[model samples]
Structures are given as C-alpha cells and as structure tokens.
Target chain A: NAGVTQTPKFRILKIGQSMTLQCTQDMNHNYMYWYRQDPGMGLKLIYYSVGAGITDKGEVPNGYNVSRSTTEDFPLRLELAAPSQTSVYFCASSYGHGELFFGEGSRLTVL
Target chain B: AQKVTQAQTEISVVEKEDVTLDCVYETRDTTYYLFWYKQPPSGELVFLIRRNSFDEQNEISGRYSWNFQKSTSSFNFTITASQVVDSAVYFCAPLTGNQFYFGTGTSLTVIP
Candidate 1:
C-alpha cells in the first residue's frame, strides 16, 4: 500500500498564480495535516483536518487554503503565490495528533 | 502560546563517537507533549520519540537515549557510537492539543 502520496513532486509558479497540492493517504487515518518547511527551519503547520469535511487553520495559514472532502484526500490551495511561499510542502497523516507519518514532499518555487 | 527551541544549530561527531542534541520548550499549559523527528535529504520525516509532560522517564533505545527533565523543560537525545547514516536534521516539537510547534532544528553530521 502506498502509505502517503503527493502529486507534482516539483512545481514552479509565478506571482499571482494559483495551484493545488494534492495529498492522498491509504491508511484511513482520521487526522491529516499540511506543513511547510523553510531553509534551516522545522516544519510549520499550515492546516489540519481531523476528518473528512472538517478543516482548521494552523500556525502559518496566511497564504494557503485547505479542504478535506474525503478520507483519502486533503488538498492545499494557493490563492496568490508569493516569493515567500516558495518552500517544500509536506502532507502528513496520523491516528492521533502526536505521532505523524509524512509524505515525500512537494517542492514549490515561486518567482 | 507554546514554543520549542533547539539550542545547537549544528553538531559534528566522528563516527563511533557520542553526541547529544538539546531541546528546551516553554508553555503555560500544565500538560503537553514533546517529540523528536529526524529528516534526511530524502525529505520524509521520521518520528523518533515522544514524551508527555508528566512522564520524565529516561529511555534508551538501541544506541539512542533520551533524557526528559520536566523541571528544566528540556528533552535531550543522545546517540552513542554514531554512524554515518545518522547525519540528518533533527527537529524538536511540542504539542498542545491538536497543534504542534516545531523548533529551528539541529543539523547533525556524523563524519567518517
């Protein structure tokens, strides 16, 4: 089973562009999260969902949006990309809030 | 508000040597959880260990050990007889409820 899979391993977007980062997990976990990692910085939570149809803002949710429509998918949307939005995005799933399993990560570059 | 801190930004140790990574956290809440995660160049995060506020049990796993001191609000990890594969960025995170706060991370390089 593919534990967690993310789409578009790499992407480049111009300022004002919009895109979606797709995340899917086969574990049927109740919790899913979106995080971004900057250079020399640890992962910062962008958004999280406890279950399908439920989502909540996280520490660094200014430039992003998320939706959890099904148990297997939680997608993060960028409304207007900025240079600061260039970072590696990771999707994680867990049985609880503590221990998490992360994806390979989606590298995004905004120019 | 909760914050996690890793004082050492970078650490280097020769293979077969021992090294320790320090982590300190702050939060007003009476109960919380602390965690350590390892991320290599491959980009996936691997969870190393987790400790709650109440439990101060010092644990040893294989060649790795952790010391959790609630009084100092510190959770330290030590690697004994390090190997080249241990080179990675280690992150310390503290969690309150559903939110997790991560530190800047400590980059550990085990050189041959």
Candidate 2:
C-alpha cells in the first residue's frame, strides 16, 4: 500500500525556472503538508492543507505555493526557483494532528 | 513561540552501547504533543514514539525507552544496545495547536 507518493524524486532547475512537486496520498487523509529540509537540518513547514479547498501558510512559505484540489493530492509550486530553495522536499499526510505519514522525499537542486 | 531543542548535534557510540538523545521543548500551551522521529540514510522518516502532555509515564519498548518530564519541559529518548541499523538522524518535534516546531536534529552514528 503506497501511503504517500511524491513525484520527481530528484530534479535540477535553473534560477527563475518553475516546477511543481506532486504529492498524493492513498490513505484518505484530510491533512496534507509540504516541508523542506536543508542539508543537515530539520523539516521546515512551507504550507499545509487541512482539507480540500483549505490551505494555510506555515513558517517558511516565501517563494512556494500550494493547492489542494482533492483529498488525495496536494501539489507545491515554485514560481521562480532560487538557489536558496535547493533542498529536500517532503510531503506528509495525517488523519489528525498525531502521527504523520511522510513520503520518500523529493530532492531539488536549483542552479 | 514553540521551539524544540536537541542539544547534541552529533554523537558516535560503539555498537552494543546505550545512547540517550536529549530533547527539550518550549511552548505556552498546556496541552501539546512531543514526538521522536528517525530518518535513516534512505531519507525517509520513521516514527519512533509520541507522548502527550497528560502522559508523563516513561515507556519502554524492546530496547527503546522514553523519559518525559513536564516540569523540565523535556522528552528524552534512550536506546539500549544501539545497533548499526539504529544509526540515523533523530528529530524531536513539539506540536501545539495546528503547527509543529522541529529541532535541528541529532545525528547518531553507531560503530561496530
């Protein structure tokens, strides 16, 4: 059973390029999140969605955008990729605020 | 503001030895949750344990144990007879309301 799946496991983009990190969960969870982890760092929340059509910004939501059109998908978009945005992106989903099921991360490198 | 602190940035211990990873948190909310997660070299997060504010009882499962002290605002994790497979980066997150605060993480290396 694939709990949470993230697309583009690894990607490299030039500065000012744009890309979307796709995330989908099969667990029918209502809460979804996008977090970025820099090298040797902890996870920093970029955005989170409680349910379909409901989204909120977290600690670091500077250059990223997110849309939750359905319960199973929450995609994060980088409008203008920057060198500072080079990090590992993780998508997670949870039933409540308890244990979070995380995807196998997407590593992105911006030149 | 919510904050989780893992004082030890990195620790190296010989296999079969016990290791204790410290986690301290700060929050104004009286009711919150503390958790420990393990991220292996594969870069996937593995849930280790979760403790709420109401439960102060220390828990032990197999070789893993947790010490939760509310007065000190600490929830520490201990691994007895650490194995090579237990080598990973551990994170402590204190979640309050709808947000979570994660520490910088402590990298643990078990040497054979």
Candidate 3:
C-alpha cells in the first residue's frame, strides 16, 4: 500500500532560490505534519494541519510555509532558500490519535 | 512544553547480545501517548511500538520488548539477541494533544 509519498527526493538550490516539497498520502488521514531533520539532531516540526484549510506553526516554522488544501496533500514551501534550510524533510499523517506514517523524506541542499 | 530525552547518544553491542535503549519524557498532560520509531540507513522511519498513558504493562514481541512506567516517566526498549540488522537510530516520541515531541534519538550499532 502507498502510505505517504513525497516528491523530489533530492534537490539542490542556490541562495535566494525557491522550491516546494510535495507530500501526499493515500490513507485519508486528517492530521498531517512537516518536519525537518538536521545533521546530528532530532526532527523538528515545521508545520501541521488538523484538516483541510486548518494549519498551524510548529517548533521551527521560520523560513518555511505550508498549506493543506485537501485531506491528502500538504506541501511545504521555501520562499527564499537559505543554507540553514538545507535539511531532510519528512511528511507524516495520522488518523485521529493513531500511529503516524511518514514519507520517504526529501533531502534538500542550499548553497 | 513536552519533552523527550534519550540520554544515550550511541550504543554498540555485539551480535546476539541484549541491548536496552532508555527514553525519558516530560509532560504536564495527564493523558498522553508514547511511541518508538526506528530509522535505518535507508532513511525511512519504521514504527516500533506505541503506549498510552494509563498502560504500564511491559510488552514483548519476538526479540523486542518495551517497558513503560508512568510513575518514572520512562519508556525503555530492549532487544534480546540483537542481530546486525537491528543497527539503526531509535527515537522516542511523547504525544500531547496533536503534537509529538521527539527525542534526539539513540544510535545503535549491532556488530557482527
């Protein structure tokens, strides 16, 4: 079964460039989240959505943005890529308070 | 604020040896959930186990076991007779409301 799918597994961007990390789930879960993992660090939440049209900021929301237009899709946007934004991003979804299913992750590099 | 701590940064054990990973959490919410996830070299996360606040019973599955003690705010994972395939980074997460606060993770190496 296709749990969570993320596109552009790897991307390299120049300074001030912009890009979007796409995330979609086929499980029809309402809770979706975006997290970034830096080297030698834990995953930090960037944004989260309870349902379509409802979004909130998480621990490390700066330099990033997200939108959940449908129940299955939550895309993270980087307006002006910075070196600090280079990290592996993961998308996850859960049904209610159930277990979370994560994507394969997208590794981004900015120079 | 909720927090999860994995004091052990890295642990190395030979094959067929038992290894234990510690997880400590801090949360003010009376009702919460705890979870363990394994991230191998493939970079994909695999769910290990989930425990609720009221459940203190230790669980065992195959060579893996979990100890949950709400009194001490600790949920530890143990692998008996670990194989080389068990080498991975283990993360502990405590969920409160809709947010999950994850620990920094403990890297385990199962040498053969």
- Each prediction's DockQ? 0.77, 0.77, 0.79
Full candidate order by DockQ, most accurate first: 3, 1, 2
In model 2, what lDDT does residue B15 have? 100
Q: TM-scores for chain B, in order?
A: 0.96, 0.98, 0.98
**Distance (Å) between predicted and true CA of A1, model 3?**
2.9
B46-111: candidate 1 lDDT, tens digit per residue? 999988899888989999999999899999999999999999999988887777788999999999
The alpha-carbon deviation from the true structure for residue A105 of candidate 3, after best TM-score superposition, in angstroms, is 0.5
Give lDDT tens digits, candidate 2, residues B15-109: 99999999999999999999899999989998989998998999999999999999999999999999999999999998888777789999999
Give the lowest summed-lDDT range of ten residues in model 2 chain B. B93-102
Which residue pairs clash in candidate 2?
Answer: none
RMSD of 3: 0.7
What is candidate 3's CAPRI-style docking category based on DockQ? medium
RMSD of each: 1.2, 0.8, 0.7
For DockQ, candidate 1 versus 3, the one ahead is 3
* Model 3 TM: 0.98
For candidate 2, give the lDDT. Answer: 0.94
Q: Model 1: runs farther than 4 Å from truth?
A: none
Residue lDDT tens for model 1, A8-101: 8999999999999999999999999999999878888999999999999998999899999899999999999999999999999988756888
